[model samples]
Target chain A: MPFVTFLDYAGVAVFAATGALAASRKELDIIGFLFLASVTGIGGGTFRDLILGIPVFWVINRDYVWICASVAVLVFLTAHRFESRYKLLLWLDAVGISAFSVMGAAKGLVVTGSVSVAIITGMLTATFGGILRDLLAGEPSVLLRPEIYVTATLIGAAVYTGADIAGLAPLLASILGFVAAFIVRGGALRFGWTFPAYKGRPGRHPDDIP
Target chain B: MPFVTFLDYAGVAVFAATGALAASRKELDIIGFLFLASVTGIGGGTFRDLILGIPVFWVINRDYVWICASVAVLVFLTAHRFESRYKLLLWLDAVGISAFSVMGAAKGLVVTGSVSVAIITGMLTATFGGILRDLLAGEPSVLLRPEIYVTATLIGAAVYTGADIAGLAPLLASILGFVAAFIVRGGALRFGWTFPAYKGRPGRHPDDIP
Candidate 1:
């Protein structure tokens, strides 16, 4: 449970950082940056919680709320020095994704007693927050990008599923899943890996072709 | 019932037009444009219905889905000439907002026995489609704008509530609500009326105060 709390905090912070960094780039004032960041950080998990008929985490736990907001403020204040080296932000985002995905999966399993649903929840927890942040920031969401974003989460879910099936301890399984996702995402960024796209080349428009 | 159905379709078409016009400005292809328009047209109703534990309108009727998509396609085929003209897009958006606000209130009242809840539902139904579209298209959502956007929907919801209490038929109540929202939003746009920021002057952070 303590470990789970750690992951939750880490996830919340990373999500906030992504939003804060993006907002800062837009020249938004500190209040605007924090507002955007807090929303982005908690957005995905809150969405999952809402759909699952649970109290929103930040609302129920003031710690989560304050942490998210504080992280955003900290990031904004320190961003000027960190801006030249942006890799730190990306790494933080990855760690956040991994942590949230693991926590989400575990929570889903605990709440629903269904592994499949839990896995889906884990994936959603990892992705939806960033998707919302990206959308609000007017960036093309990763869903449309040739990025392996969802794939990383899917693989993480699968790892978690496998651990569950093998009767591995839940905490261990979560850790394993998190590591898997983190590595996949980090390796992709480092090696310039990308998913394939249908680049609007002269493809046969079967719908248009009578 | 038949009249209600007519209004719903008209609302969806109008919202779809607004989405298509906005997405076209971003040079999104038909798929992206349609996706945006569909969300703009139905996102609020779907969310409202889902929260109310009722089946989403499009999922239950399918007619709603077809109307949104087909309108989007039709609009896309003619977008080049229209998207550049901001006034045209604004006009379409206003129509969509008005119709959606009315229908939202009408349906909410029909489904829920509480007038206050109905008002909230109406406001959500009128506003969320645009909130969603803005999120998707990476524009600042109208909800966040310093304008009387959502206030108009709230007033319209109130009028709808009054009409319902006054023994007006559902269709008449819906029409009156739509006209109220249309006139308010149209007047705001025409006169460039906007809400002033609530910020107190510089060097005075309310949060920072001892």
Candidate 2:
């Protein structure tokens, strides 16, 4: 595989593992784990493609699906042994998120020719899948949290776009974007940094249950 | 309100109610119910628009959001009494489904000018919300069920396309499509008719699940 393909596969594995872990937290069965993993691995790219009016990438290329499945299976088999090792999981997720964020921005810029849209797409591509996983798992989505999830991705997207405009090679731009996102996310985690919550009100709840 | 707006509001209400019922079955809290109801109300249309490369309709149109919220709250309050007395929820759902199916097709056709694509969009718009609700509710998605769900929508889409091609008025074509879908779906439900399931075929999982 070429460098891009190799890195993309690695990112897929990490993201799929994150999905498997989320399913395990919810005590879902193996099938649920696989489904979650596949969605997390491909969700960002699908959103990008859908917005770009391109055919969804995974639907056209089966390799991504195959990798997701394999990773889910591997994670399921070895998950118990790694149950206590949460730091490693978080780091893996950070790496995958950073890489995917840059990749998403690059794809968006190439397809749409709009830097602002590319930035938004990059952030969405990085966080949307995890958000879905969290929502389905009945947790507060990262988007709703005070954490610097999308902010880190936005910074990375800006950096990547700027680098590309300055005539940097795509490979170099991607590597720098990935590093930028990873560092910001890691710093946020280390320092317990967060965005502002509405001073006191998280907003009133709607009356009546679903 | 225009006739189209009336139908659209009614459709939103019905879908929101359906979403509430699904969320109730899953025992979601009030906020979660709101979330599901909102998604169920707008989810399918959003998917269709996204695929067609448009800004999401709800984000652009505020009325859709308010109508769905109102309907969800009303249904949450009145479900037990209303469900027991009239037994009309099923009828209302069928009507809503048919109308939305036609509208979905019309919108897609107007945007893409492709009959096949319009039919697919119609089916998606009619059914995708239900799928989202089912998935989040941890129930099997309707798409995976051996059912004639898409078939009913397909008939409506074809009728609408044919009527439009023959120079029929848009309103008349829409009504014809809606009625065609309503009949097919109503018949299927009344007779407990469903599609044939694949026993030994593609997309089959291994026999490890219970």
lDDT score, candidate 1, position A119: 84
A106: Cα error in model 1, Å: 1.2
DockQ of candidate 2 compared with the true complex: 0.06
Off by over 4 Å in 1: A50-55, A84-86, A143-147, A194-210, B1-128, B135-210
- Give the Å shift of residue A183 in candidate 1: 1.6
- lDDT for each residue of candidate 1 in A1-210, tens digit (9 for 90 to 100): 667778888888888888877665545555455556766788778777866877556544557657777887787667766533235645676777788778888778778878888889988988888887766655456565444667778778778777877899877887898899888887776775677756777667889887
- TM-score per candidate, in order? 0.56, 0.56
On the 0 to 100 scale, the lDDT of residue B184 in model 2 is 82
Error of 1 at B19 (Å): 7.0
lDDT of 2 by residue, A2-45 (tens): 44455567767788888776655544545555666776787777
lDDT of 2: 0.71
